[model samples]
Target: MEKKPFFQGLTKKTIALALAVILWAFTNFELDVERDVRIPLHLSGLPEDLIIVNNAPENVDLSLRGARNLLSSFAFSNKSIPVDLQKTERGVLKIDLKRAASQIVPRGIDIVAARPSKLSLNIDMLVTKRFKVKPVLGEPDSGYEISKKLKIVPQFVKVKGPASQLGKLESIETAKIKLEGEKAEFTAPVQLQLPSQYMEVLEGDHVNVTVYIKEIILSKEFRDVDIVPRNFGELEYTTTPELKATLVFNGPYKTINDLTSNDVKVFIDGAEMGESRVKRLRVKVQYPNSDLLKLTKTSPTSVRVRVKPPPPEESPET
Candidate 1:
């Protein structure tokens, strides 16, 4: 009785320690703790032909309550709440967050509340359209002009976006490419201007633009070109000073250099001066390939012409 076995004492102490641990665990499990956690909001079951045009919530604020011990060891990483839209149509969709909280929260945690009880989403039908790519270029250097039409590789782009927005879009423009003080032909890689955050160029985001520039040459002048009368009926017409003028025109070097007075016709319309003896008429210029040349100047813009009835035909052998 006076001396106890060492092994017996050790056994009793172990039992007591075991009991204490069990009691501590029981108490901790009964106590509740609250925590506010941020969980990512995931979208699911969206139709392939639909898109969300409006900004949707990225994360949800969740208030969770659970046993103290469970709360202490809880991890919030990679947890998400999903909003299903499989059967949702194009319109404003209101989602009840409370209903979805149970599906995402950890097993032991209870959802106390969600900051936003409801979420509103704006959905639209997705569509694709072809849009012409327009190059945005700054003014070229002085005395220079764009000689030929700009050439864009992949002139058209396929764009995808919400149907409502895509319907209004006709063309996409490239970012401003500065041609100020630029001369000669050059190419540049430029990004397309996006219509909105919801719209994207499905083909590509960038394009290569080839610009053709040429120095503006001085206009070539053809002097002493004869002016003729046209649309004359049974009348004779004559102009003062024999109706001659100088013509000035600008065009490609080859085209303008090869042009001659015979290639151009300066005329006055006789029909426009009906029954008038003396009339002032405007001079008009014409050429076989008129589109190639730009008329810059003309001397004697108007001509004074005298119109008279043709002399009575001489009676033959009465």
Candidate 2:
């Protein structure tokens, strides 16, 4: 019986295999390596009374140095840097990003360097403010008008946002409501338009808006309206002044805009004249659609009329 040597069968092939394994270990596990890894930045512990107004980095780049295997595993792992803002106050805050990077680093891996070693943050106080709700509207049909007094169910709304931003806000407008071809009053539910991205509607997000629509009223002046003499016989007669009148008409927009001087008439009634050679005659006006149209004013409301005396031609002819 014989005892086998501890290094029995140590051939050239075996020696080469051992060396290859050792080199792989040094390259992957024992030797130190550097790598740049990007990890998410988690923000927590922020005071409820404060808000961040500036653009903050969502992820930070970390230069890590450690064994190749460890760093590779850590880089691929789901890990984030947790930032605690429990002691933060309203204003600009400078943060040490290196400290944050070191906190979440694994036990073996070392943080060689961190991009953006510091962060400049803009903070503001959280506040609630009330603002008037302005209703937005589109153009109505032609010859129609919308009332100036818009009825909103909740006239005012309360919003919570950064104090600095809220200071510049005047009024919040509602989602645009179209009044195109609208002929009558209507009520609709409308969403509000937030002025700032950081603002949240705490009281009223949607409101009921009552829009009033009516036919537009307009005034038109008809110049140089003819004033004719009515019931005047063949006898010669003359008026104190050239018979011309001006009229101002008030009515619906469509009717007034379409009306013309020909649609109206003015006349002096000679039948109502007295025996006086010279007499004052009152002028009268007439027009179609009087129910919807009204004659607001008439220039030269009265005129003087004279009857010419006939010549004594009968005695001369005889």
Query: In lDDT terms, how accurate is model 1?
Result: 0.85
What global local distance difference test value does model 2 have?
Answer: 0.87
lDDT of 2 by residue, 151-264 (tens): 998999999999999999999999899999888899999999997788999975899999999999999987787899999887678886678898998998898898888878
Could you estimate the TM-score for every candidate? Answer: 0.59, 0.78
| Model 2 / residue 112 / CA error / Å | 4.2
State each model's C-alpha RMSD to the native: 13.6, 4.4
TM-score of 1: 0.59
